[model samples]
Target: MTTAPGPAYRSAPTTFGAVARHGRAWLPVIGLTALASSAVSLALPSVLGHSVDAIVAGSGYGRWFTIAAVLIGVGVLCSLIDAFAGTACVAGTTAWLRHGLVSQVVRGGAEGSREFDSGDLVSRVSGNASDAAQAGPAAVTTVAATAPPIGSLVLLALIDPWLAVAFFGGVILVVGVLFVFARRTAEISLSYQQTQGRISALLTEAVTGLRTIASAGTTTREERRILGFLPELHRHGLETWKVLARSGAQAAIVGPLVLVAVLAVGGLQLVDGRITPGELFAASQYAVLGAGLGSLTGVIGEIARARAGIQRAAEVFAIDKVAHGLLPLPPGPGRLTFDGVTVVADDAVLLENIHLELPGGATIAVVGPSGAGKSVLASLAARLRDPSIGQVLLDGVPLPALNHHALRTAVGCAFERPTLVGTTVGDAISHDAIGPVRTLAAARATHAHDFVRRLPDGYFTPLPKAPMSGGERQRLGLARAWPASRLLVLDDATSSLDTATELQISKTLTEDRYRRTRLIVTHRTATAARADLVVWLDGGRVRGVGSHQDLWQDASYREVFG
Candidate 1:
């Protein structure tokens, strides 16, 4: 779901504490309600104890009973308030976290987010964000949930010193149970979520390539590959249950000890006439309250899960998006210049320091062998990515210095495997907000108009119902990119078209009716021959920069087309 950036508090937080503050506005309400619930719980025992004393003494106990009933109602009311406040806090914070994450993904764009798999990104944005958003409520609730036990300790001491002393030992055991559980669960939860993300990433990849898998008769194999991590996931799930079972067993055995101890000590006190029957009853209730620490297991588990999610989201936040400058483009022809550019990834050079300058309104063909970095060069022309060691200037301004709107509007790029995003065929072809005239012109120029008019609903047909072949989709992509005012970088964007259609499209592109610079990455020799200039690249560096006829004299250059 796309949303505008929220208030300043909605920015990505690098730590769990920062994530908790996303619910800061709701924290006080949650805390007050929780404390109110705890107070009602603590007060009820004394009221009931007093009523018991009055009944035993054969006096009026109606007032105390009424106060006890009122306390129960107040407790229920506080509980309802806590439930609503906690839910709102979690949901609001989740949305905030999600908004920040999705914004970052958009800001980072493809190049900045290339390190993350699409499926993995979906998992991070959907499940992980929700989990992380629980930090605020979980932290507050976990602390608030401890109040009853702590309050019981103080009240037990007030009633009789021996009762408090007896129950104190049990509280220590409860603390140990919580500590061990938190530590064990935290590690496992992180691993579990990471495994889930991996599986999600695999499933996403499979979906994108489902047609290939089916054609290759590897659907069963793809399914097996996608589910390969199930064993590990199952192990993690089993481990989590085991940890919960152990914690439960510990609580079941140890939680009652505090109550039994309090009762035993209070019994002795009662026998010696040191504590009244009412006081003993009150002390027993306090003991039960103190023993309730075991229930915090659920809250602690939530905190652990929240922490793991926070960590995952924080990693995404750590990746810096490519920064764009605010300067608008100065008026000039679309002369593109790459000054000593080099691109390296994973310790391997994709493009070595290469220098080239192409004049505006020229059709430049970049031809290369399989790994000769033709696509990378085209990407630079469109500013899809920045060079690792140099700068690309459109006209006179560095591409990074131009305002984003200016940069995007001036340079349009189309890829061979273009992903159509809009709902209808018209929407897809005109996604860049070009006017009807330009949109129709682009469609006609690229021959997409012919097929589009034949669709069942013409341009209004839904993309899923359009049933376009690869070449038709390429034409639509070219149409989508045709509105550029300055430069159009076609990265093998017409490879799927038949030779006849490719020729017509090439004629339009080379004629430069739009008066924009065209950088075409192509494997076809005819397309290269049509260009005003040819860039022959070998390995990651340019071997020659000349016209196609001149470059054709080289045997190695001829081999590039082969």
Candidate 2:
């Protein structure tokens, strides 16, 4: 199967549209509420203009008082509506964005697509998604809020076109300034976010390898490397703020200047009888409304940043590829075959032109020197990685064609470095399908049962909260895997165990009681001695395949053994 494309190439709308469809009901509600709120806010200035006109006309005191009271009431009502709508929009968008991001991460899978970087994926899912969540509601609300001011501008133009022209002109200038600065702000913000992700990944790697760093006396140097990224992050933040600050100053200074200019021109018009006092007052109020609209420049900047975040999030959701096998295997007790298979990675052939067959209820040992690709060969048989050429089959069917989950269920692997789950030893082995057999059974097989039983809670004991020795962890890892999979693959799994323990486990696995195919990848001559067949690999090719004694008699095999 072809590998999936990376996150960068996928269409953003596919992801955004999916989120919107899922959140349609709430999104519309937020938009409608915001529209209503903006309408109410727009009414306030109109009502105030009416009240001022009434006072100027020498209307009854009670009439002017009533208009003022109505304006105040409308202002209060709009504030409440704005608060409620803002809260709903923010809460709904946050929930949707978080949910969508999580779904994307899950579907992307743990092994990840070859094209996507794990560090970048982490940052997009965790940090960029958060930024989108925080910004979505405000951005939606701002767009909604723009509508009423636009409508009011139309109404103002009908009242007096010259004043309307001034309002539009001022808005254009402010918007132009905002757009220019917004681009710079967005670029810097994206850089900062990407850098932060890289820093986090570096820290995670350092922490996970703390022992190695400490042992090598390289902790200080590693720390300094991490610290070095901070200056770059700081510089990006500073640059973004500088651009934003300059844009904000321009908006602040220009908005009031436009308002003052409009007011002065309107006053001159009123004196010249081109309009009434009430008309001039209304026009000035409209100018202020336009100024309020201009303030959305700051909101526009926020939106630019949010758009960058959305793009980042979109990149993560784009990765649709995962490693998969190209063929299927027929169902039966696990019978494995390697048909002229070769494995290559990083332009180096690790396993080449190897042919082998492992029948059900049989044990085979794969013997090779280090870097001979014995483990790589075993992993291919289990379909961990596809063969560079040729095919591996299970039960007469190609391995890749088997359903991935089913294939994994049929095959279990115990790595050279074992991995255990859960804290308590009993917790680790309690539910293993092999039996309710205590941790001791598994530990004893690998000679870990004794040391574990001596701990405070014995089989019920928990591992230390801190890190443990590699060998101890590996033993526990094997104990966990041994009982879980039907077709067991032990890739140097017993390397940590003493010779006696390794022999015991090997003997137990060889018995009819196990009744499973076992592929042991090891360097131990004793392990090969116990196998029904020994496949010797050398320089990525099959050097020999036969009983250990048969290979021992061959000149090539004897030379290596000697």
Best candidate (score: lDDT): 1
Off by over 4 Å in 1: 1-13
lDDT of 1 at 502: 94
What digit string (tens of lDDT, one per residue) describes model 1 on residues 452-491?
A: 9999998889999999899999999999998888999999
What is the lDDT of every predicted structure here? 0.87, 0.69
For 261-301, candidate 2 gives per-residue lDDT tens digits of 77877777777888777677777777777666656656666
**Residue 473 miss distance in model 2 (angstroms):** 1.7
Which window of ten consecutive residues has the lowest lDDT sum in model 1? 1-10
TM-score, one value per model: 0.96, 0.84
